[model samples]
Target: MICFMKNNLIVSIQLPLLILFFCSCSLLNADEGKEFISIFDGKTLKGWRKAPKTSYEPWSVNDGVIRGEGKENRLVYLVYSEDENLKNFELKFRYKMVTKGNTGVEVRTRIDKTGKRPFEGYHADLGHVGIGPGVLGAWDFHFGSGTRKEFPCQRGTRLVIDSEGNGKHSPIKDAINITEIKKRDWNDCCIVAKGNFFQLWINDKLSSEFTDHISEGRLESGFIGLQLHDKGMVVKFKDLFLKKL
Candidate 1:
């Protein structure tokens, strides 16, 4: 009878420890699976470079945030210079647009001195559009020298871009929830690019996606940049992270 009682006590003790061990192992595996690298230190722009004509006063690091304020006559970009080129990767960051203006992130783009726009590449657009703020999450292609300078795909669109820089968009039944995006508040933005596939997520909701089949005009690889569009605008970005697949 004493042995039976002792065995019961041991089993009760071992069961919780075993359960905890398994839970810890599962958590360790999950953390190991996600190999995200921090691109921004949140205190300084150590691995970033601004466009030639851009002023430093408008771009400053304040309280662990990359803050952009004031005005510029033209668009300017703070390009990531630490990495050579990003081809197949997932980039994520938190951004807040305080002013009623435009801001975006450029991917697979390069600096074009002759181009009219600040960055010549693909842009994940954020901010207001038209009379309403419906087009906060969208995608745009800014070709440096093409006849079609800009090609846009709106939120909840599954688009296809051809080699001639022409785009065809189809509505994605129920992908986006616009109400989830907090205007003038900190929002999450994620971009995934793999080969010809590209996707954008805002506030953990799928906003837009596209496939590029443009053999001649498609960009395979280029630098990543943060854009400040229009004058008298303020935008803050933080928690910039990237994972290469």
Candidate 2:
């Protein structure tokens, strides 16, 4: 009986330790298996190009950052065409608004050759407060008919759109506080797109959540771009990373 009790105690201890060891290894493997790829070279615009209709001439790279000085008469875009047709992926980058009017990151976008707007897609909106209502920390939708829907998913809101283009939203209590966004400092932005679900995080806080069931209006694959909204807006982007999910 004494020998059996000793063996039982040993087994109990060993079992817990073994389980812990396997869990640690599993976490390590999951972290190591992430396949994030840096999209920007930080030295030159090797894999990106300016849109054909971009009248602005101030898009440049300096000090390992992509800078856009919006001095154009209209909106312009710097497109990422190296892998234009990305279906579902995760994108992360850091941005700083030097002198903000309005700026945004475009995903699943296509250039409209004969349209007034430069591209058609979903925009992750960012701008200084008082620029406009939908210009800051929201999701804007642009369609081919020049239909722009601003603030479909606002900051601190969770939204769901039905197949017929109907939407419903509610406030998320734990979402990012827009006041925490720095005016003249760098901010982190992360976008995750999987199937019909999309999430946007700013400064590591959930800013917006969206699920699109609208098959007709949804885009499955398209290019990415950085927007220069009108004139007198200055923005910089760095550390652009993408992971195919």
Candidate 3:
């Protein structure tokens, strides 16, 4: 009887130890991923500029949030820039909608003082609904303005850039799949842009995968912006951290 009790204790202890070892290994494997950078400092818009606005209201960084209040069907943008060049880096941020509307992170797009509608650019094309058709994962030739009648060109399609970072868009990346994260709740988004390929991870789950080739523009590196749709739209972002992998 004594020997049997001792054997049972050994088995219990060994099982717990084995469980712990496997858990540690899982965490280590997760850490071994590509590099990334966090554009938001959660303090101020240090690397951003309040670009030309189409409305009187503007985008601002306050207490670590990049926020916008939409107006006139034009939610302007606050853009970012860096003196150094960047390539093949992932960016992560948390976005929460104060109220449901349209918004998305803008990448590889540019604007001038005239607020000339994302001059020569691409927008992520995000709304409350997720459809695998647009610049990021879906397509609708949605020009700068909204329209009931569709254009001759397709909308909701992703863009393509060359090695020099200049290119036009095509349907090479077929469709984008997004994780249906909860609205008004803090959800993490990861964007990986490498040459003509980009991938998106939502809430730590692989969502959209994009690979395209275009020759209209180059995307070696460019400003990042957060946009809100028309007026009364508000979204909050926080705890944005990135490590270049």
Candidate 4:
């Protein structure tokens, strides 16, 4: 009886440790072993579609790049329609803006057709404000379902978003050099989303990081999109790629 009790204790202890060991190994492999796949063929928009009630189709493939140009009165998106909803992924692309244009990349966002807005989710903003000209690389949430229209975290901020679509920002350590971004020129953007953790980079520089703990408004999985905010601006995107984690 004594020996059986000792064996049972050892087994119970080993089981939890073994589970932890396997979980750590899986996470390490997921970060290092996964390979990126090109979602855009560089020559077409075959796997993407415009959101519903988009007044006009402003996106097209030209010269090996996906281009959007128009004077839209509201938010417009070219959403990736091929994959199942993405839960955790890393996405990268190159983009260029022309003539005071405003644009962004949307991740883990859903189309809200019932409302006036076309999408409901997060946006990684790209463009110049009064501060300067280049990729601001700010983080924002567009709340289509609630009274909150947008929650914005300025450049160089590490933001925390709560369940009610509100945010608080602080200066980030090892922030990216915003000067390195080339205005009106092609620059690389990378976004990593895993669970409620998120990171954004511009031109290989770390831009922003955030943890979303919104129990009520947290988004686990949704579509990917490129945004054209308004009229009289041209935005071009290319080399769109993703790696599922």
Any runs in candidate 1 off by more than 4 Å, and if so which? Answer: 1-34, 128-135, 147-149, 162-166
Error of 2 at 82 (Å): 0.9
TM-score of each: 0.80, 0.81, 0.60, 0.79
Error of 1 at 204 (Å): 1.0
Worst 10 residues of 4 by lDDT: 20-29
lDDT, residue 88, model 2: 78
Clashes of 1: 1
Error of 4 at 235 (Å): 0.6
> Which candidate would rank higher by lDDT, 2 or 3?
2
TM-score of the candidate numbered 3? 0.60
> What is the Cα-based lDDT of residue 204 in candidate 4?
62
User: What do the candidate models score in CA lDDT, each in turn?
Assistant: 0.74, 0.74, 0.51, 0.74
Worst 10-residue lDDT window, candidate 1: 21-30
Alpha carbon lDDT at 172, candidate 4:
79
For residues 1-245, what per-residue lDDT tens digits would candidate 2 score against the true structure? 01235578787776764344223212212334467778998889999988755544768999889998877767777888789998777777878889857888888887655485767778788877556535666777777763434336777788888766678898877787768788878887777777887777777677787888878657777888888886888899987887776
Candidate 2 CA-lDDT value: 0.74
Predicted candidate 3 versus true structure: per-residue lDDT over 136-181, tens digit per residue: 2232222233311222212323344343534354442423244456
lDDT of 3 at 209: 42
